[model samples]
Target: MTIVDVPGSKSITARALFLAAAAEGTTTLVRPLLSDDTEGFAEGLLALGYRVERRPDRWLVQGSPTGPAAREARVYCRDGATTARFLPALAAAGRGDFRFDASAQMRRRPVAPLTRALRGLGVEVRHLEAEGHHPLGITADGIEGGELTLDAGESSQYLTALLMLGPLTRQGLRITVTRLVSAPYVEITLAMMRAFGVEVERRDSPEGEVFDVPPGGYRATTYAIEPDASTASYFFAAAALMGHEVTVAGLGRGALQGDLRFVEVLERMGARVRVTDEATTVAGTGTLDGLTVNMRDVSDTMPTLAALAPFASGPVRIEDVANTRVKECDRLEACAENLRRMGVPVRTGPDWIEIDPAAPGPAEIATHGDHRMVMSFAVASLRTPGVTFDDPGCVRKTFPGFHEAFAALREQWQGLAARR
Candidate 1:
């Protein structure tokens, strides 16, 4: 059996940084992802006067329970949306004048929903340049938390930021989510918060969904991050494409990331999947079935599914993924455009895409600076020889060693084919 060791979860790493920084003692993160996004998150914490020791294996963070030591600071989030969204809320927990800026790509992503929610909590938030975009400035005397409502239709990060900040608020926080997308990510946030010794009260009400967070801060402890299931999807997709077995270690049936549900889609496409306590394996049956899948909750894997769709026996229709349009790039359009470039016929609507199976030809896929695009199209390379990428290095956002890993897997697959 061939096993791939993927990096730790970016989501969990970012959340751990936030929770550890806000906790009252020292916390150690075991085997956290060391990628651009996570590095940006750690940098943001450092800017707030939190001490983070980066080691060869683990990260040690000294908690700042009373919030940031520096009253005024500037945090540059680069292209990390999680850092861009979550750090501002963390800044609001402190009494400071803080400015948040991001890379050109992240500046285009929306932050107004989170800003509005912060305003409702009596924190003054201003966009230094654009109205709803990045380059934001916040003047905070700590969150005067109260009842607030926000729409999370554009991105779930807004709700996650608010939920992470809930425990630090003076009056606690009562959040009514008007429109929630990627609901599973909020579950991840709540679950991690609980692990950090904070419990968020959740209930479904007539006025949408309500989360009541009491005013009790987090408790610091040693936390181990799970492998990124989203990154593992690429290896699984490769298995489906080449009729081989690909196992991703450290992500299993009980993984915290909702993207682990992506294996269900692979199973629906006629792939055999075994998820145990330690690892998840995907074995292909030499054929794939096309089906309609709604990937709203686990949208990160939509690109992987799109890459695999062209090789399936029938058409694959992916629906409820409009939120993908607002990600690092217009991912839905990027996927459709790249698939068309690869000679696959793709039809798209505002919230759905249908891909028809066709003979894929070699094409240099434009990655649009989105990491998912770079990684997804790499799976297509296993079947098509001439599959290349315009910006393959964009995968450094989440998986810096992705190309090397993919190459190693290809060599292993070829060796197995020769032995057979």
Candidate 2:
């Protein structure tokens, strides 16, 4: 059996790197995603005057007083949600005019929540073309972080965008989110905020939860990103569906990523999960039992669960994830539609979806040009042969070698089948 340390948490690494880029001095990122998202983010920083060193393993980012930058530049962040959402506010905070644009997918992606939030905080951000979308012309401006409510129903990036900007505001930002989905991502935001230097407090009341982020900038420090739990998820789900033992390395107990809680979801679904300081192990039970789960907090794991659902005995229902409508794609619909195409009994609605395992049939899968879709279906291929993807390279957005890894695993499975 081959052991693989799961890819580094792209979510955590990107968030940490963005925060580190704004700190006072040079910071060393121990393990960051060397993918397109981070590269785009670093390019954005470079355009805004931060010195970035792209190394073999780690990235060294030199931070300075972001008043005047190298030059006024335009940043095309591609389709990376993190770079698209986080860089705009940082560009504005640096008080330099920036023309921020993105790929067609990113153009369609919602940014109005963030622009509205920025406008409320007193930044002069205007859309060049679409009313609430990207292609923003941001004049160097700083806002007094004030109390405001954000409609983060689409994606948690809206909340995270503000969280990163709150501490940098002239006045600390007190934020109250309306229908804040992906609460774990917000928790990840808070954890990263606390790690860097922002002391944000959350209090519970009858009205809702309130966050008080003090007015300050992040502090530069040596930071390490945890292994990507979301990437490890497909492996774990494969083990559960195929009864193979899978161990994901480099994940720590105190990992800043809330997606790490995905191991808990696997456990509840009947996979035996063990967590150590260095790694997480999911021992396959050969077959997973169906689960009726609310994945609002861990929505990134939804596809993995859907892939594993066909192996379960009963119907699996995923709830509280309506926000999946605006992820890299309409993940809920995309996932459900794929499963239905596979002849699995699947039901979907505005916020929830149900998948009941049935006699598997032939289905040509559509990735919808989303990375997560590509990886989740790779897990399904182990159980059902003749399954191919529309765009396999989509995994490069997170893990580039995903299909290759699955191919290696399939070879061994084929060898075993030949002997049988």
Candidate 3:
């Protein structure tokens, strides 16, 4: 059996940085993802006067128990949405003045929901340029941490940021989630918080879901990150498309990422899946039956599923992923446009997309500067020649060596074909 060891999880890596920085002592993160987004997150922590030691195999972070050492600092989040959203909440826990900015692309994303929630929690946040976007000024004397209501329909990161700050609040924190999407990601946040020695009480209510976070801080500890399940989706999709077997090591049945559920989607579409303690394997059956899938909980793999749709025996309908529109690009529109470029028939709605199987020809796929778009569409290149990307390097956001890894997969596939 051949196994591919993918890089560590981006989501977990970002969360580890935030948790480690807020902990009381030194925390070591093992096998973290070293990419543009995660690096941006680490840099943001360093700017707040947190000490981070970067080693080839691990990262050591010396956290400030009271708060950030820097009373006032400016942090540039670059294109990392997690950094842009989570860091401000981390800043709120400290007695300091912070000015947060981001890249031009990140400036277009939404941060107002989180900012509004912060203001309700006694943090002073001002939007410098736009009302609901980045380039904000924040002045916080530490989180008061009382009951607050938040609308998390736009992005679950808002809820996650607030939840992470719950244990740091003066009065503890009770959050009423008005509109929640991507509940699984919140599960990840809760899980990580518990790992850091904080417990959040959760219950389902008529208003929505309620969380009670006790007044305490995180304890520093050693944590190991799992391989990225979202990035592994492309290779899994490759197996489904080309009737090959691909196994991603370091991601097992116990993986924390919700995107690992993507393999279940492939299974429902007639692909074979085997998940063990060591690794998860996806083997194609040379036949794909299109099916309707709701991707609300695992929306990150929407593009990978869309790429595999064209090779299916029937149409694939993906629903409950309107949030994809708010990602790095309007992913729904980008997927539609790219499918049209490849001569595939596609129908789209506000929160759903139906892709009909067709013989896609050679075409240049526009990536819209989204890393997932580039990696997802690259899978189509395996079965259809002349498939190219507009900006392949945009994959540096998460997987800097994506093109090289993809080439290795192709070589492996060719070797398998020669054996056949």
Candidate 4:
């Protein structure tokens, strides 16, 4: 079996940075993800006057319960949605006049739900440009938090931002989420918060899911980040499509990422999947059975599945991923457009896409500057020669060495085939 070492999770690293900054002592994050998005998060923390010492594999963040040391700061969030959404809430809990902006792509994404919740909790939020979009300013005098309601159907980051901000408030926070998508991500947030010393009370009420966070703040600790399961999906897809055995290190049945469930989709498609306490492995069975799937919780793998659907024996239908449209790009349309370019039959609606089985042809995939787009289409390149990406380097958003790693794997698989 080909064992691959995937990078640390972007989600976990971002949440850890927030937790470490809010805790009472210095936090050491072991194996934190190093990428444009994550580095941007550390830099945003520095801009807010939080001390962050970065090394190759670990990050040290000094916590300040009172809030940012810089009374005035300007943070460019780059293309990371977590940095854009979570940092503003982090700044709001401190005493500061912080201005936040993002890349043009991130600026187009909405953040009104988060801002609205912050306003309800009495934080000063100003939309410098379009309403509900970034390029916003937070004039903070510290949060005296109480009860508030929010709609988090568009993105779960809104809820995560508020959840992380809960302990920093004077009265703590009681959040009632009216609508929530990507529920598993919220679970990750709760678990990480518990690890850092705070426990949030969650219950399903008649109104919605209520989270009661107490005011006592967090205590810093050493946290080891798990390897990214979303990044592993690409290599797993590669093994399935090419009939090879691949094992991803640092992920198992007990892994926190909901994206790890992508192997279940592969299992349903006739691949053999083995899960242990320490790792998970996928082996191809030389047969791919297409089926319908709902990927609301693990929607980040939608593009990976879309890229492999053409090789299946029947139509592959993906459903309940409407929120994907508002991601880095319109993912549904991007997948359909690229598949059509490869001369594959595909159809899409507001939230679903169906792909008919075919031998996908050569085409130049439009990356749209989204990292997932580049990584997903790279899997399709395995069987279809001449398949290329318009912007292969865009994978730097999450995995800077993705191309090199994937290429080495291809060489190993080829050598194994030659021996066989």
For each candidate in turn, the TM-score is 0.99, 0.94, 0.99, 0.99
Model with the higher lDDT, candidate 2 or 4: 4
Residue range 129-232, candidate 1, lDDT tens digits: 98999999999898778898889988889999988888887778898987988888888899899999998888888888999998878899999999998999
Q: Tell me, by lDDT, which candidate is best.
A: 4
- Per-residue CA lDDT of model 3 for 113-182, tens digit only, reads 9998888877889999999899999998987789998999888999999888887788889999988888
Off by over 4 Å in 2: 65-71, 205-207, 412-420
Go through the candidates in order and give each one's C-alpha lDDT.
0.91, 0.80, 0.91, 0.95
**What value of lDDT does candidate 4 attain over all alpha carbons?**
0.95
Clashing pairs in 2: 9-228, 95-140, 96-140
Ranking by TM-score: 4, 1, 3, 2
lDDT of 4 by residue, 49-73 (tens): 9999999889999999888889999
The deviation in Å at residue 300 for candidate 1 is 0.5
Which residue pairs come into collision in candidate 3? none
Model 3: CA > 4 A from native: none
Q: Model 1: which residue pairs collide?
A: none
Candidate 1 similarity to native, TM-score? 0.99
lDDT of 2 by residue, 1-420 (tens): 446666678888878877887788888988787777777788877877788898877889886534326448788898888988898877767665788999888888889999988888778889999999988988765665679887787778888988887777777888887667777788888888788878788887555677888876878888877778888888877777776667777875866666778778778878888888877787777667778888888898888888778878788899988877888889999998898888888999888999987766667789887899988888887777778888878788888777777777667656865898
lDDT of 2: 0.80
Clashes of each: 0, 3, 0, 0
Q: What is the lDDT for 289 in model 1?
A: 96
